[model samples]
Target chain A: MGVTSRGFAVLFLAGFAAQPAFAYKIFVSNEKSNDVTVLDGDTLEVIDTFEVGQRPRGITVANDGNHLLVAVGDDDTVEVYDTETYERLHTLPSGPDPELFVLHPSGNPLYIANEDDNLVTVVDLENRSMIAEIPVGVEPEGMGVSPDGSVIVNTSETTNMAHFIDTESHEIVANVLVDQRPRFAEFKSDGSEVWVSSEIGGTVSVIDPATHEIKHKIEFDIPGLRPEAIQPVGVRITEDMETAFVALGPANRVAVVDPETYEVLDYLLVGQRVWQLGFSPDESLLFSTNGVSNDISVIDVEDREVTKSVQVGEFPWGVVTTPD
Target chain B: MMPARFLLAAAFAVAAGGAAAQEAARLDPDWPCVQRKVPTLTPAAIWTGPAIEEAGDWRDDEEVRELVNLLSQRRVPQDEAEATIESFAEGLPAEERSARLTLLFAGLFDTMNAERSEIIEGIERYARHQKALVETIREQKETVEVSPVGTGSEAEQQLFWNLRIFEERRQSLPYICEVPRLVEQRLFALGRAIGTVVSE
Candidate 1:
């Protein structure tokens, strides 16, 4: 169609908006590298690298498209960056050694797992101040909030329990014992169940969210691979909640399982010490950070194979996809 | 002939009496030095201690003999060899003492290099394990979540719980890395102290 400059500009804007906004930009926090590596999910290519605070680990794209949140464990602060320009935006003062975090669905409050103090510091995002600190078990590692936003789960390493906290009161309502050294917890999209992965125990326990009872334990076996090597860390559940991808630490593999049946369908080999996993918004691609290899293994979910391995900073850990 | 025999017997008796008298005179402080010629050993003739005495005894035992031969062949320090032998001897019981001492001496006499090698292997294993743990925890920070999601109210609550997990992970890293280094350093200092004593 022929058009004037203003008409062409209007057509271009319409075309861009009409296109499916499914593809998401991904940000990976390289812990040892102390930087964030940005990737274009569709092309599986690194777009940019931005220097972050010391030892950036867990990364999350804020619900609003404006900022990217990163957990800088060494710096003891959670840093926010402008997503468009990839510039430092602000810092959230999380109490002592902030590690992993989960955002409330409402997005005004931030739940931070301060690994050093054995407490979860709740921060008011608007005020940028800690609202409350909830005590938890030893070595709290992974966390997840229920889809309904009624409950929150915090997994403790030594305690081996996933503690359920009431979102309103910020109090631990229930504690369900799971496998040894529970490192991460993920909630089913429907809020029907919760999954906890144990690093030392080499198993993932699927728990009934309501009853806080373990429904099943998923185990792995491969000769010469020690149970320790099969340490399960980052867990990603598909939006449909039909499949679960678990990063097997030191094993350099990610196990894809049927969530409903608790059946492991296949083990996709990735890189050394795979620590965290994130998926594009469209759920077509999966990205995992290989801590030892210092690379991000991008998986084509439909094909169930590693499509590309992008070299990142030293010891990449947590990864998140930003909406494009 | 009888007279001559009596005279001879008397002379013999007199000579015996004179010899006895001379022996008694020698015992007396008044005895003349010229009259009594007594042989004297020098101060250096007396045994120094058990170590010197045992060195002579070491010649008879096969294990001791082997150890001495080995030490001589290996050119180990004389004091170290002596000390090793003494330690082995002290550990032995009275009944099997000789055999045990001999065996120990023989085995250790020429095996100083082997002992040193064993010690090095042990230290290397310990150090490597310590380093591995430190590196593992240092790398653990990457796997940890250190930031909270500040979004909607519901999301903020989720971030709060997630942060609890991160704090636990953070607290553990230093404990895992620092505790081992502290313990290893302490153990190393103790080893150095012991080494100083042994070297001396």
Candidate 2:
């Protein structure tokens, strides 16, 4: 049973295509160190670290589950890398200062936020060129793709608005103003509501996608701390669409909230200045990247407690894990 | 050039659609402003800042918290307010009947000049205080960004830029010009009252 080069390639691709339900590898984008740190998702231990662009912030596992898409702001390009080999594949036409992005379900067109330029650059994955540069609000950071892939939302920090763009037309159909300094946007698995976290407002605004208006707000109140310190930044809803975890920027806590009630259930204390979050493919374990502490805290989603902390590179800004 | 036009068009469209977010009040609208909305400081809390039992975060620095409590009122402090306007309100009625009208007039002019000085001094202090607030926020920001526990080197370049922008004279200086006019209006009203009393 000798495996030739072609047969090995097939086997390699099959391993990626059919990701085992239990296998998980977490990738963290470190901004200050200009690298990406890979971790064992189960043990929460540092597996490897590879040099990326000048300042890598936003990272995402490609929908195909074989590549990692990282928005290198300093380089003004979204560099793709082979998930297994950890080698740079190519760069996307992400315009200037690409910070965060969301890929289409088909993984053909990529929607990226260019923070400095105040535009969302849509690049065609097949052509490796920009398809359309959608003009968004100032300092765009968060990108959310709908479950049905019909529309995508981009939240602007300084603008303090969540903009909904029609995927087909690639135009902003509506803009809904939320609280101050909106940093991240997330849609429920069922596509019923979209949650946007306002860093300065210290609250998560639950907006109705159909109405394009804020339905309710989820606020945090930590014991012995002022409300101002509860800066909500990263938000992720669970696969079952029952729970949501929001990363508090300076508060160093992740608030577990009920999606239906918009009530904060509990605050899970993690490392310092928790910036972004990731989850395993099976949605069992959740990972949080603490930039100030330079570590990743793994939490059992069911238990809602931080089980382990894995030290990584400097100032980790984003995190993504292998797909199921 | 195209981007400029696109930006203008987008602004106009957003304005027309009534979907633009409310623009925050800035000393200078042209420059980027720092986020200052503290959640615990409700409208009622701002109205009665000193009465707040526990302003949790600001408690670390008693002096800064005190200053913040004062600024939350959105006006000059009591001592400065008194020296500028309140003294004039009560100064004239205290003069003796034997006090010459001419002397009283001279004193009134002197008092106005003194009030002017105090208002100018208030502007300087206010600038210094606001600059300090920027520094405090920068230090807090660096705590999570590039402080001892975090990565990077000594000194924060973003904070330096933040301080410069926050303290830019063009922004807050206009407010300084307005304070004097408002204080003078108060003094002028008091002077009129003094004149009427003498006429009677």
Candidate 3:
């Protein structure tokens, strides 16, 4: 084989070899209990549970994977905790009522959705200052930053629009009107399209990233489920961009879809009121936060079976794992 | 010199108004029920309600009969649910039963009023916060030339749209008229539950 072909073979093998020996931990923010539950991702056992703040909801690991950032909406601050020691670190200037946020790829800035204030607060993590407060539609919540770090998109719950905010300039470049109660926004790994899930609308709008126009909408129907029950919330797309998963809020099922063809493949039954989802570092497992049941259903990604359900804190809202 | 029919009609109207007033008056003013619904906000808001659901677990189209039926099935075994309800109703005195009803009516009334209060209060708070955000945006507009893709006017427009929604909801509060019917239905359910409790 030529040198280019040999290099491709070596890189592919390296990727497969790196899948094993993945050490990571999962952190869940409990909205009612005002605490976070940290778990061992491999064993699915609780490592520790500690008080973070009041009404903790959105959570994610820091870009460096050293700290866990918990968006405490009631406390109006994003609390940071050390990943190694699980100790309380400093807090960041998250705008009023920070519900959800996305970290820029470069990792210094945080874009937060201030639901009550109707603004997207951009914070500079290193300087710890409010860099820019970009006004969005009513009840800004789900945030998705582009893989290239050039732009980030936010979904407004009340205004029902997917707003494209330019990262460098901190301005909303485009607004695409969506259905009622748009809850979460997810972009493909390739940055080709942005998928926005509307909770009440019960549809996912796939928008063209370049033109800010909706190319298509993916709809769902379950055999015995009522139409209202199929409320879509969280969305996740595989790295290969071949598959996508959407959490149907009250339906207690995750709709697995083919991203390429936009086909609904199957619905995996999860716990009650599945609101958010997280994938294991290696993509072998997916964890879902069932708000009503107060437990998380762990789905084996390959087998697509709900292997186990871990009882967590009351009304769990957000889930994230340390970076691989 | 007024006709008997006119006097009767006047009496009926007065009775109706009194009944309406009593519906919302179930909770004593001091009973922590009439207190502000927002619950003191932190000087800085920490976290907020789910963006998908501003009023958690509250559906605008909720019906009283549906709720009562659901609550009737809770924790109580289906076979024994009616008997359990009947026994509880039988144990209470007639006056006590009436009092429970009053409290329930108060609860239902407070519920609607609380919802109304939340919308009003939330809008007020939104307005206050929106002002601050607009000020920040204005400063950014002056200092930093906005992105090549968007202008500062777009951000302001979003805020304007949000405020308009709040104002619309505020004005339509009285017309939505969700509370009075809700109170009547809750009482209806309470009566049914009582009947079940006292039944064999």
| Per-residue C-alpha lDDT of model 2 across residues A1-324, encoded as one tens digit per residue | 456988999998999888755557889999989999998765677889999998999898874789899999999899999988899999988999999988887776889999999999998887798889989999999999988899999999999999999999988999999899999989998888999989999988888899898889888887656787789998988989877899996676788988888788988767667878878888888889887667777888999977766778988999998775
Per-residue accuracy of model 2 over B1-200 as CA lDDT, tens digit each: 12222322343342222212124223332212232212121212101112222323333544434433332232555336334333333444545321332233334334444565676566556555654654464454646344443334444444444444443543565566555444443333333333334444
Candidate 3 stretches greater than 4 Å from native: A1-22, B1-200
lDDT by residue for model 1 (A1-324), tens: 456888989999999999767556788888877888888767778889999999887778775767789989888999999987988978998877888999887776888888888998888878798888999999787889998888889998888889999989989989998889998889889888888999988999999988878889999764445555578898989989877899987666899998888888988767666889998878888989987556788888888877667778888888888765
Per-prediction TM-score, please? 0.61, 0.60, 0.61
Ranking by lDDT: 3, 2, 1
> What lDDT would candidate 2 get against the real structure?
0.71
Worst 10 residues of 3 chain A by lDDT: A221-230
lDDT of 3 at A186: 93
Ranking by DockQ: 3, 2, 1
Candidate 2 segments whose C-alpha is farther than 4 A from its true place? A1-22, B1-200
DockQ of 1: 0.01
Give one digit per residue, the lDDT tens place, for model 3 in B10-88.
4334323344344433442211112222322110011111121222232332443343344333354533644544554
Can you give the lDDT of residue A170 in candidate 2?
86
